[model samples]
Every structure is written in structure tokens, then in C-alpha cells.
Target: MLQQETRDMDGHYEFVTVSDEATIAFRRYGTPGKPRLLLIHSLALDGSIWTDVISGLQGQAEILCIDCRGHGWSSRAPLSYAIERYADDAAEVLDKVGWDQVVVAGCSMGGCIAQAFAVRYPKRVSAMILIDTTAWYGEKAPQEWRARAQKARAEGLASMAAFQATRWFGDRFRAENPRKIQEMMEIFVRNDLDAYEATCIMLGDADLRSALSGFHFPVSVIVGEEDYATPIESARQLAKAIPGASLTILPGARHLTPIECSDVIAEAIAKMIEAAAH
Candidate 1:
């Protein structure tokens, strides 16, 4: 069973200077003795999105949730964004904490980074958990998404927030969770347009499908039941492609299921970890 937090929980937050100039902000939750689980956020969102999931897993695992470079509290870098770069940043965070092995989990863009990490540094990852993402870039993404990236590069983040909102959430979620929708929009708006545009280009260019099949570690794939962005069909294909991988569907969930349905997501991940222990 998933552990429930009956009382308010607080965690310690700090910054690690990864590349001399760039400082990555991370929040540490749970005790020092527990196994560490790294949580990566989706594009336009920060580590805070994992709050709900963390609440359930805190009793079982220590979580190190990072705000990727160019998003949230992390310092922007002059370098162009890539999944590899994000993986390197994650490695840096783990190095700082002295965790040689960990369960790496990511959502959407974060999931892409996790795959990159597992492929590049297999020795560092004990297991991998991916949510609502693909190992390869979309075969034919909406042309308007590319257009929006270009617009953001030229105009600014404010002009791109609406498109982000539409792409990140399903219609029903946007209708029912107006407050959450508005909050996410604000985060996207807060992002530096150049960085966001660069990240979008990186996402479009990433293709790790070939490398995914080679990973020997335990892998679990998850998706929202109603995820239209990546879709459950695509996630199922990913599950089939990777060896010994299992897939779970979060019911009544949208693309933002990690945030909207954190309790279930956290429990699913916790259960996966427990099962892996044997």
C-alpha cells in the first residue's frame, strides 16, 4: 500500500553549481538513509509538479527533484538545450549527493532525459520509470507546434503560453482544473523564450528509440488514460519495444496526470520499486 502523509511535510532545498556558471536547484525530501529516487519534470514545469507524488513516496524513498537548466529556479546556460545536457545535469546532481545508484524517473521531457541517462550511464541507474513520453520524437507532430516555437523565439514566452497550455493538457482537464491550468500557464510565461524555443528544437531532434531496446535494467512505462499528446497507443508500443518493461495506465488522467493525479502516480511508482527490490 502507498504511504499517506497525514501531516504537513517540509523539505530542504539547495542549489548545486553544476558547470561553474550554471546552478541547478534541487529539493530533497525524506530521510538520508532511504534510497534516492530522482524526479525530472516535464517541459515548462518545475520540480514542484511532483509534490503530490513525493508526499506518498517520502516515507519509502528519498527524492531529489531537480529544476532543469532554463526552467524554474535553475540558472539558464548559454549552451543549447538537449536531452543529453539534461542527463548530464542530472548526473551532476547525483554526484553532488554521492548517490552512485538510483531509480531514475521522468515525465514527458523528463522521461526523454531519463532514457538518455539510462543509455549513457547505465551503471548509475538501478532502474528506470517513464511516464507519458516516448523514446523517439513524434513521427509527425502538429506543424503549429513548430510554428509556435518559432513565434516564441521571435515574440516571447507570453505569446507561447496558450499553445503550451493546449499541448500539455486535454480539453477536459483545462475545463475542470482552471486554477492548475492558470498556474502552469504562468510558469511557461516565466520561462525565457529563447531557452524554451531551444528546448523545443532539442525535443524535436531527439531520437533514442534505437538505444532504448539495449537497456537491460528494469523499466516501467506509464501514461494517463486520456493522454492525447503522446497517447496510450504510443506508450504501449514503447513498452513492447523495451525488454522486461511494464506499462500502467492512470485512469481519468490527462497529459498532466503526474500533477493532477499524483497520488496514484506515486503509488504506482512506489509499488514498482517495491516489486523490484525482490
Candidate 2:
């Protein structure tokens, strides 16, 4: 039997075995009968990153926040942590919860997995919101990611926290929200080294550019004006590729738009859910 624990009054933490060696941890929020929303977080970050977004969405929808394989309390099995694999794990979560369709929202690495999920399981995704992510990382990204992975394995995640923070938040936001920045940095530092390394490789290899044209669902691409990791240009390209996709760029935000601009993202997701329902 999978180990299950209820966290707080509004959220339930549960683990579902997705593979022989892997068990994925996820949190359930809001009422079950309401519209379902699956929230996926960025690389190295867990589902807790969506706390504010979940709060903003209270009483509006049933939210399932997944800690993707190799992150958070999810098991770090000896499996390839590819983006497609992450998508499959997410589908397993839906299957476990008996949800037929959901509004899938993901940020950064999670966005890549969301793209894979939409492409592979078109019938299961009602809508998709890609946040602070791109369809591809260019030709040189794989090499750079591999190197980073090697370094993380050697030096540990704590060494990368400060550097990653720079890409995750803009200078002004970091200065204004020092506590929040430190909280996120702590999350990064707590990551398992092997899982972090594997995820870096996953991000490096994932390229969904050619696959975007096939996504027929209502799509919304949101980016931060100051996102250095996945820039606004990448978001524009993704919006152009997906049919009828709308693009929104939040000013003064960085790679962590979902955290830095939770209200805006929550509102956008609410609109997407509303449009998908009709």
C-alpha cells in the first residue's frame, strides 16, 4: 500500500506508485466535484511552490499539485527522468484520482512535462498553461545542462542555490521579497543531488518545438519580462506555434513567475478554466 498523509486541513498528501521503483507524491486541494486543475512545478522545486496559487484559487477548483519524480517527497527511482516520463507519471496521478480531464498548468521544467502530456495524452488535457518555459532550449542547451548536472553531482545543490536565484527572480523582486527568496533558495538546497542532476539532464534533452503544432486545446503561455532562463522571446515563439494561444508577459517578474506573480497567474488560470468549460 502507498503511504498517505494528510497535510493541514485543506490539503492531502498522497503517494501513488507509478512504476515498480517509483512512487510519486502529490497534494490534493479544494472540493473534488469542482473543475480539476493539475499544477506542476519547476525543476528542483516541489508542489509547495503553488501554495499561494492554490490559496488564490480557493473554492474555485480542485487542484492537484504534483511533486514530479525525483523532487520533493517523490521517490528517486533508478529510472530515466525524461520529460516524457514525467508526463506519464502525471497521467498516473490522474488515473489514481479518477479524473478524466484536467486543466494542466506547469512552470519551467514542469511546462515541458505539460507539453509532453498534452501531446501524448491529448484527450486527458482540457487546457494547458505554459508558464516561464519554452518549447526548446536551443542546440547548445543539452551540453550546458549536462555540464551543470555533472557539477551538481560533484558539488551539491547548495552550491547552485545562489546562482539559480539570480535566474529565478529579478534584482528588484529579490531585494523587496528577501524572505520569499530565501525560502525558495532553501527549497533548492534541500533537493536530492541525484534527482537534481537527473532533472537537469531532462531539461537539457527536452525539445517540444515540433510537437506544439498538434496541441489543439486552449493554450495560454505566460512569461516574466525578466525571465533569463526561458526568456519572453521563447514564450512568444511558443504562443506562435500553438493554435489560438494567448501570451501574457508579467513585468518585473523573473523565471519564477508563478511565485513572483501568483495572483496574475491564478487569474489567468481561472480564465482558462472558464473558457475551457464553455
Candidate 3:
């Protein structure tokens, strides 16, 4: 449903069709056998959301940045959107790419997808890093998420660009990188309204807290000190849910740390790569 790639990055785009008939889009980067990574982007955004961070992790990590169904070049599935379906799509993509296992990392909606992947395809994931996301949005999440979806349906995704900008980055990052902000805004407006609403309702009902204790792989939780979207409490809860998981909170950063705290994120991935090798 999205147009051809518009980001400034040079990732080689590829496409694959899952069992459900939705065509998914992904980009390959780095070399093989050097810490395989799978990066998932936030809601209303595509895999290119990791453009800046992917550049930082290049050469050292073989990575796949996937545009989840209905988000980017991926098809807007005729069925309703669900986190588990997205996870299954990731696994199918892995089969096509020949990746046996990968360090799954996701931000916001992607982070929720990462959690679902860990639960549904335990053998397919080597490690996981959850960023700026939560296992659940809380007691009133269903109502709140539905309301947000209706607002978008009525007013269009463009109406929330300013809000998304504020939640995604801090004043400093916004002032320093206006073009990236503009691109993000564009992506938000380009989303399919129906798919966007379904995805929101899916997220509203998504609950992975019960499965966190079952996670066998190494889990790392990262959050920005100023991230009110998921917030510090959410990251703390996630960290506590998984045994042996480490939590890192970046100072002065907001929800999208992949852009503002890319160096720190790269360091975290390096550490995970080392841990997996041992």
C-alpha cells in the first residue's frame, strides 16, 4: 500500500509473500554470520525508521529491517492486524532470507512484535532488545487505543504528525534533524487508514506479559528517560518480567532512541552479539 522506498538510505529492498497472502517488504544489510539482527519499526512507520541506527550497526551486524504488513511497501492484509500475525510474517521472511536465528529488536509497535515473536517462535530468535514499548498498554488500553484509531480515521494520520513528533523526539533532536522529522511525518500521513485503525485495535488488545517469564533467550530492555509513550515504568515492568534481562535508560532521549541514542543502541547490540557467541 506504500509507495516505493523514499528514504535516503541505500538498503537493498526485497519482498516476500507469507502464507496469508500479504506481501512483506524488507531490506538486507551487513555481512552474514556477524550477529544477525531483525529491526522492527513503530506503528505508522516503516522499517526505514531504523535508517540512522542501521548505518551505525553496519559492517559488524548482518541485519534485516522489515516493513510489517500495512506499514510500508508491505501489503495491507485483507484480514485484521494482529501482533502474532506480524511475528509469523517475520519468521516466514527469515525462511526466505535463510537466517536460522536473529537478534530481534523492535521499537514501539515493533517492540511489541518482538515480544510476540519471542513467545510464538522461540527457536527462531537468538536474543531480543525491546525499545520504547510495553507488553500491555494498561487497563484502559482497549478503549484508549480505539479512541486514537477513530480520531485518525476521522481526521487522517496527518493530523497526529505534530503529536507523533513530540512523542518520538525531544526538542534538541527535533531542532537538529528537521529533514528526518519531515520524512517521519510523511510516512505517518501515507499509512492506509483502514490498516492503521486495525493495527491500533490489535495493539490495544495485545498482551504479552504472561509469556515474558517463558522467554529463554537473553532480553535487553531500553527506554528513554523522557519517553512518555511507553514511559520508564513500562520498561521497568518489562525488564522485571523477563528473567536476567537488562534495562538501560537513556538520559534526555525520548521514545525513538534509535535516532537520538544510536551509539548507545549499537553498543548494546555489540554486547548482545558477544553474549550470544559465548
The runs of at least 3 residues in candidate 2 whose Cα sits more than 4 Å from the true structure, single-residue gaps closed, are 1-10
For candidate 1, lDDT tens digit of each residue in 17-112? 876458889888876666678999998779988887988786788788999988899987476476787898999999998888888889998998
lDDT of 3: 0.89
**Each prediction's whole-model lDDT (CA):** 0.81, 0.89, 0.89
TM-scores for all candidates? 0.89, 0.94, 0.95
Q: Which portions of model 1 miss their true places by more than 4 Å?
A: 1-8, 140-145, 170-176
Full-model lDDT, candidate 2: 0.89
Cα lDDT for residue 164, model 3?
90
lDDT of 3 by residue, 70-103 (tens): 8899998466487889999999999998888889
How far does residue 72 in candidate 1 sit from its true spot (Å)?
A: 0.7
lDDT of 2 by residue, 29-136 (tens): 876577899999999889988888888888788889999998888997466787888999999999998998999999999899999999889999899999999889
lDDT of 2 at 179: 92
